[model samples]
Target: MEWLVSGLIFLHVTSGAVALVTFWLPLLLPKGKQAHRVTGRVFAISMIVCGVIAMVLASFHLTSPQWVEGAADTRLQLGWMMLYLGLLATVLVLFGLKTVRNKGRHHLYKTTWILFLHGALALLAAWVFWLGWSQRELLLIGVAFIAFLMVPGNLRFILRKPVAAPGKLRREWLYQHFTSMIGAGIAGYSAFLSFGAAMYMPTHAFNPYLWTIPTILGVSFMMWLSKRQPRYD
Candidate 1:
């Protein structure tokens, strides 16, 4: 039973890791249409499964409740849940619209959504920590908000036009997208593996925030390193 459970957890995390790289590499690196299409399919299917499985397993675990309430706090808890759910639905709608409106640019839209997962996951971590009232929960607060910032960054640089200068363009579009995407892929793998280990380890609970600090610094460093002046004709 122990080994079997561990294996399932490993599968779930491994899938998400592959999905992360496949999904984001194109966005960050921008290889070409062919590579983009192949990875996109891989990422989407993998993540959906990962999320579904994790959600189910979470039911059996003794994690903290979603909310705690005093009289006035009841509405706040409801609002919090509603806000996250509503944003999730809205993101889906917008991405769907982007797919339709920019049919030729499907990768752009999809990557944006996946990138948003950083914020979504981080924010969720924060909430879990807060509700659990665990001292360790405090760790993820900054990381979660930073994930939100990535939403705009991807939108401006990725979903929109290439911002790099023509002359300074050492690497091509697909390459840059690939780096970030692959970096994300690697990051996902690292985080997922970490999570899986935590999940089954029985020692410390799977604190999603475990990866938070590293993620924050890593993202900032990479973004700075990767920035370029737009190539103007």
Candidate 2:
């Protein structure tokens, strides 16, 4: 049971890592649609199972006993678990509701939003877990509140009519995004593996923000230099 739980967590992390690396590449590259969709299905299933099993095992986890005064502070693990649950619920809600009616405008916008939410939060959590940092609640709460404000701005950016044609936009930005995705994915997956492996006692799971020097540096470097923009605007 111990290995089984840990194995599932590991598999989940692996899938997430693979997906992240490939996430943008497929969109902007000449990948087969069928293959992409099939992989997406696999990722979705893996994530759901990971979420459910994590919740169930949270009870049996003897490392951090639930909410003590200050013996070891298991609440950090619980907080991450809750975040996991929230991510799971958000994905299910988005995938569950599908409609042909909201085609042109409403459908596109809603689907876009839900997909954005899922990807954003999932990737964000992945990055956080990878670093094994401190879970300062005040910072997280403030970030969350500000994040909501950024959502609409992001949506606008995605849904806006592009000045360039589809083909041109694809040509111009695909490689850059693909590069960044791979770099980001590596950093995030490393975090996931590290967290699961180190979940031994003072697991850095609850530290909210990631703090590992390597991961922190890797993420920073990737974000700063992942993609090279073409000189010709």
Positional deviation of residue 157's Cα in model 2 after best superposition, in angstroms: 3.1
Number of colliding residue pairs in each model: 21, 4
Model 2 regions lying over 4 Å from their true place: 1-154, 165-187, 190-194, 201-215, 224-227, 231-233
Clashes of 1: 21
**Which candidate number has the best TM-score?**
1
For each candidate, give its TM-score against the true structure.
0.46, 0.42
RMSD of 2: 8.3
Give the number of the best model, judged by lDDT. Answer: 1
For residues 17-133, could you state the per-residue lDDT of candidate 1 as single tens digits? 666556555454543477765665566556555545444334323232332222333233323322332232233323323433443343455464555753564466457436435
Q: What is the lDDT of residue 96 in candidate 2?
A: 25
Model 1 ranges with Cα > 4 A deviation: 1-14, 20-30, 62-126, 132-134, 151-187, 199-233
What are the lDDT scores of the predictions, listed in order?
0.44, 0.42
